[model samples]
Target chain A: SQQGEEDPQALSIQEGENATMNCSYKTSINNLQWYRQNSGRGLVHLILIRSNEREKHSGRLRVTLDTSKKSSSLLITASRAADTASYFCATEHDTSGSRLTFGEGTQLTVNP
Target chain B: DAGITQSPRYKITETGRQVTLMCHQTWSHSYMFWYRQDLGHGLRLIYYSAAADITDKGEVPDGYVVSRSKTENFPLTLESATRSQTSVYFCASSETGNTIYFGEGSWLTVV
Candidate 1:
């Protein structure tokens, strides 16, 4: 079963613009992680935010987690064409050990 | 090398045939997982192993079987190939389950 559900199934933005994607999960989680996948490539881990953390940043990627709302959001500042790919949000449920359930994913297309 | 590796990166099999996708990780991570990626499904876990000789089913494990005989090897097998089983398979491993590393992937086509 899918624990996380990402909003904005698809998004198209111009280069240098900011892109934001949201993910909502069904149950309590230990942590949430974001991953990026380019065309025909394996997924690359972007960032991870623990349940206690409200927000975390890495390079141009920012991730915020709201435990109360069971939701998390990923923001990419000054998006570049290279950032175009399918972004996925995975939740590690509190009860599931070493298991991460992924969302449908958000397909972001950055036009240069 | 020092990361997760998948063998038979691409394969085509006929219906009712048995197929196996091999995964080997040199990190010696205790936790390993198998996931399948489809067009709309993104990625779904098929099986996972906490350690050698221990395996469990995940979200979609109906026609699939997984075995982890060694700490570094986790292989997924399709008992009877079906068109629905055709998808890209990814193998991942993590020492503490906090961060996972994924293999390139294996493209399996069932006809």
Candidate 2:
């Protein structure tokens, strides 16, 4: 079963603009991670935020976790065309032990 | 050669036929996972192994079987291929509590 659900199933934005995607999960989690897939091939790990962390950043990617709301959001600043891909949010439940349940995903298209 | 790879990038099989998708990782990560991606369904874990000789089922393990006899290899088998089993399969591995790396994935079609 899918424990996480991403909002804005699809988003189209112009290059250089900022894009934000939100995810909501059903249960308590130890950490939340975001992954990017281009052309449905392989998935690349974007970033991860622990339950105790309210926000984290890597390059242009920013991730925020709200444990109380069971939700997380990914923000990509100055989005580039190369950043166009399907982004998924996965939650590692408190007791899952290395297992991650993924959300449907958000397809972001960055237009040049 | 330094990362994860999935064999038989594409496969076509008939119902009742048995097919296998192979995954090999050179990182020697203790944790390996198998997940299938389908339209509107996202990716669902099929199975995972914490270490060689130990494996566990995930949300959707109905027609699939996984075996991890070695730390570098994990193979997923379709006992009885069916149309519903058609999907893209991804293999991933990670250190105990680190970021996971994914293979290119195998596209399987059941006719």
Candidate 3:
């Protein structure tokens, strides 16, 4: 079963606009990471927010984790056309072994 | 240097034939993973290995087999390829449990 579920199945916005995607999980997690996948390509790691941390940033990507609500969000500021891709959230549980459960993902299109 | 590489890049095989997808990483990451991407299913984990000689099944592990004989190599094999197994397969590796690096992916088509 999928531990994470991303909201807003798809989104379309202008190149300069911002795109925000949300993810919700069911159980406790050690960390939540976001990944971007271009069409017909593999996933690229974006940012990871640990359970103890509230927010983290990498370049124009911002990730926030709220353990209390079991939810996390990824925000891409001033989105570019190249940033158009599918984004997914993966949850790493605090278990003995490391196994990541991923969400369905959100497809974002940055229109020029 | 290739961080991680997967081959044959693209493959086409007949149903009931066995096919193996190979993944190799240069970082010697302790953990490796195999995932399949479908139209609506997103990325589903098929199998993962913590280290050499250790492997475990993931959510969609059925119909798939994996082995991590070495820290840098993890291979996924479909015992009997089926049309449902036709999808893009991605392999990922991580030094630890937190961050993962992925390969370019292998496109497999079972006819």
Candidate 4:
């Protein structure tokens, strides 16, 4: 199975703080992507980092990928109440024909 | 706006019945996918189509069927639904198989 496993199944933080989630997969990947899902809502794409790329940033979200370790991390800085959501890490393998295997996700709660 | 959409946002069906969840995308993407979300499993792929008339099974394709007769539409059908089939089904599409756009999802209940 190429499924990614996310550490810290749940995280709670106060507003203006940072939240970090990690994902690890056993298989080689072409790219790793992060998504955010609010309760009862569809997932929204956040960031994508290729295997060759070690790190990328999008607004308040920062993603790091280490192919040597087969792990990735997502960090959201200065989180707000509106940023509370479930974060998922999906891995796309080079041989998968674009199929993405997702992790169980990290449920983040930002309190005001 | 160009986006993906799904039909039957919510449905409650009985066992041994047939249910079809419809998915349509305006982007004319060649890749379309069907995934089911559960409490602890996150999202598991059920079926995927690379193009019109080209469909393949995913990790959890059993008890589910999918057809893509048109480039903009792909529908997932469940034959002889079971209680375990109850889940939130999502339809997603991608233009170049990189970034995926997902629909709101359909909540299905089989009793």
User: Which candidate number has the best TM-score?
Assistant: 4
Can you write out model 1's per-residue Cα lDDT over A39-102, one digit (the tens) per residue? Answer: 8889999998988899999999999999999999999999999999999999888544479989
Backbone clash pairs in model 2 (N, Cα, C under 3 Å; residues 3+ apart or in different chains), count: 0
Best by DockQ: 3
Candidate 4 lDDT, B1-111, residue by residue in tens: 889999999999999999999999999889999999996558999998889999999999999999998999999999899999999999999855489889999999999
- Tell me how candidate 2 scores on lDDT: 0.90
Q: Each model's DockQ?
A: 0.66, 0.67, 0.68, 0.62
lDDT of each: 0.91, 0.90, 0.90, 0.92
* DockQ rank order: 3, 2, 1, 4
lDDT accuracy of residue B94 in candidate 1: 86
lDDT of 4 by residue, A1-112 (tens): 8899998999999999999999999988888999999989888999989888999999999999999899999999999999999999998886444788999999999999
State the displacement of the C-alpha of residue A5, model 3, in Å, after optimal TM-score superposition: 1.0
Question: Model 2's DockQ?
Answer: 0.67
Using lDDT as the measure, which candidate wins? 4
Q: Kindly indicate the candidate among 1 and 3 with the higher lDDT.
A: 1
User: Could you tell me how far off, in angstroms, the CA of residue A79 lies in candidate 3 after the best superposition?
Assistant: 1.3
Sort order, TM-score high to low: 4, 1, 2, 3
- Model 1, range B9-110, lDDT digits (tens) per residue? 999999999999999999889999999999666789999998999899888899998998899999999999999998999999986648888999999999
lDDT tens string, model 2, A1-112? 4489999999999999999999999888888899999985789999988888999999999999999999999999999999999999998885444788899899999999
TM-score, candidate 4, first chain:
0.97
Native-referenced DockQ of model 4: 0.62
Model 4 chain A is weakest, by summed lDDT over 10 consecutive residues, at A91-100
Per model, how much of the real contact set is kept? 0.56, 0.63, 0.58, 0.46
What tens digits encode model 3's per-residue C-alpha lDDT throughout A1-112?
5479999999999999999999999999988999999988889998888888999999998899999999999999999999999999999986645678889999999999
Model 1's alpha-carbon lDDT is 0.91
